[model samples]
Target: MPTLLTVDIGGTNCRFARFSIEKGALTLAGTARRQTADIPDTQALMDACAEALIAPGEADALVIGMAGPIAGQRRARLTNAPLELDLSDAETRYGVGACLLVNDFLAEACACLTPIGAGAFPVLGPRDAATGDGTIGIIGAGTGLGTASLVRDSRGAWLPLPAEGGHAAFPFTGKEEADFQAFAASALGLSYLRGDDVLTGRGLCLLHAFLTGERREAAEVAAQGLSRETETLRWYARFYGRACRDWALSTLCTGGLFITGGIARRNPLVMRCASFRESFYDSPQRSLLERLPVRRYADEASGLWGSAWLAARLIGALPA
Candidate 1:
């Protein structure tokens, strides 16, 4: 059996796990989690992970799914968090045989390719039998908005395609939407607003202030269940649905659209609301959207599993 160390580094928390691979299957061996704020930088984060999860030389490989853009095969810079990682340095500092870094959503997308277990629930449309030849799309809101795709290659292996589509210009459907865009642009001192400006955890607070001239943390607003807060969540869900619909149409994702992130998982009512499905199916491609299966992934440890899967593949322990 081969052992692989996997880490999911996010803005709020960092999760680490060790997996044992045998006969192309991965079994969770040990796991630990810590607040990213407590560990200021990547070096410290990796050191803490190794201390909590495994001995320095026990793992064969290290795979990290980080909440940021991967500049090259060896380096990644997290977006919301103050951390930059060089996988090359990790190999020396952690005593791992190999290290791989990828965008966090790419790991989430990889998880969609495998059996997701029971951490997923339907949100819109009926579950359709995937033809196994089309694309699978994923969109979620956490510390930031994330997007990715899974497509089959010529060899029939599913390939993870990571994207920073979250920073794309947010779509505006009406004057109210346009007003929000202008407000966000002026507030952020940008010419235009990106999706993350209005769809993330911080974005929720911003939206609340825009709507009611009030400032509250995302969690506080969510807990209050006030009319204004409810309105904010509905707006968030609607935009999220639109984002998902756009990705689905662009990728022709006949497989399914899987929603995973801290926000959606924590607020099941908002996901199940009619506002979400209404906006998702409001497109001109109504027939296509209706046939698409949409689900909210409930598991927080999904990225860890995904990183392990990639590690197993990289080590040739799993078939492509």
Candidate 2:
């Protein structure tokens, strides 16, 4: 059996898992978590993540999926968090035979390639829409917006394309939107707002504040089953749809769009809301947008599983 230690680092929390593969099937040995805010130091936090999954020298491979752009494949710092990781010495210092690092959404894309992927997410649009062919686009919003795409190669092998699309500027048109943009700019102290900042859980809080003139946490807003008239959820849904629309068009996805994250997955009402459909289909190329099937990855531990799956592949335990 091939043993692996995997880590999924997001803005809010860190998930650690120990996986063993046999006969190409993944078995979860154990799992653990630590809040990102609780990380007192970089070295200590890394050690804690490693030991939580497996003892030193026990893991054949260590794989990590992080919520930021990967640098030279093994170096990255979280976009919304303060932790910076340089895993250049992991193979020796961490006692793992190898270390693999990738953008968190790239791991999310790879998860949809596995059997668990097939049984995990539910389609949100027309059942007949997704043919499960051609290129697939993945986007999700939680603490931050994450994006990636999966494409088939000449060998028919699926290859993952990672992106920093979330960091790109998000557009706001019309007077109402312009007003909110100005307010957000003032609130966030950023003249130029990125998609990651505006289409995220934090963004939902901002929307709530703008609508009600009251500040609330993201969880509070998500939990309150407020009506459509509230406008907070309506605008959030609209922004999410816009993000999805841009990614689908940029990737030119024929397979369909896979949406995942704590936002739409935990509270599916956002995807079903009329505002989402309207904004998504509002593009000048409306027909093209309508043709794209949509699905949402629902598993909360999706990134952890994705990291383990990619780890197995990187270590030659599973087919690439």
Candidate 3:
């Protein structure tokens, strides 16, 4: 089986996997990942991936799931990477004929079309949820925030819609704007709203810093089992809940709201907190919001599956 090299890159880490199409299904072979800060440039990263696979010329195509925006058909660059990645260059470097760029979260959502492991049940809201036409929403809080939608078309196929929802202004709900504004003014040096500033891992840290008066990574706060009685931790939980609620309202994810990413899934306290549900249903349309089912993307390989699926489609190896 010819290999397909897949890379899932985020602000913090880079995950690489090798997949081969087998009898109409994607089978994983070898996988490796590295931290972004450790790598110096794009070439080095790609080289590391090639080395991990141990077969430089075996892959038929390369699929990159990047944290940045992808545009046009032939070339793309990373929004956060200091260096630019030209996909067409691969024709010479790897002798590969094709390259594909896709949003990392979109890949994860597409992977959800397949069966995954258990999920963290979420509190979903109702709006236009009906048979055959309702939309599915994915809100992931990881190194950063990621939002995507799966809309069921008339033909009944789940179509993926990718967008920069994380960059959207963080809509303040009641005192949320006030609290967020204060945090931003004091830390970020700007009071304007940013969805990532509140919905991401760093956002959680920012909230912790404001309430706890200590600067630390959000993942650390949740991992260390910090004193829940501390006002800072309490405030962080409240804000986290509020952020999830806000996305739920915007999407009206009656089909269901999926919360994924490292920060969200690792923090069981955040999910179990009563405030999380309360804030989720705190909207004026609580009755409508109460009916939506919510869950977390439990499968870590979900993103890898997405990349492989897209690769199969682009190569015309699978029916659309």
How many clashes does each candidate structure show, in the order listed? 0, 0, 3
| Local accuracy of candidate 1 as per-residue lDDT tens digits, 101-178 | 999998998886555623578777775444356788888888888999889999998888999989998888899988
Better of 1 and 2 by lDDT: 2
Runs in model 2 with CA error above 4 Å? 40-42, 120-124, 128-131, 225-229
Which window of ten consecutive residues has the lowest lDDT sum in model 2?
A: 122-131
lDDT of 3 at 267: 65
Alpha-carbon deviation at 108 in model 1, angstroms? 0.3
Residue 286 of model 2: what lDDT? Answer: 86
Report how far residue 15 has shifted in candidate 3, in Å. 0.1
Query: How well is each residue in 142-201 modelled by candidate 2, as lDDT tens digits?
Result: 999999999989887778999988989998879998888888888999977888878787
- The models' CA-based lDDT, in order, is 0.80, 0.81, 0.68
Please estimate how well model 2 matches the true structure, expressed as its whole-model Cα lDDT.
0.81
Model 3 lDDT on a 0 to 1 scale: 0.68
Give the lDDT of residue 256 in candidate 3: 70
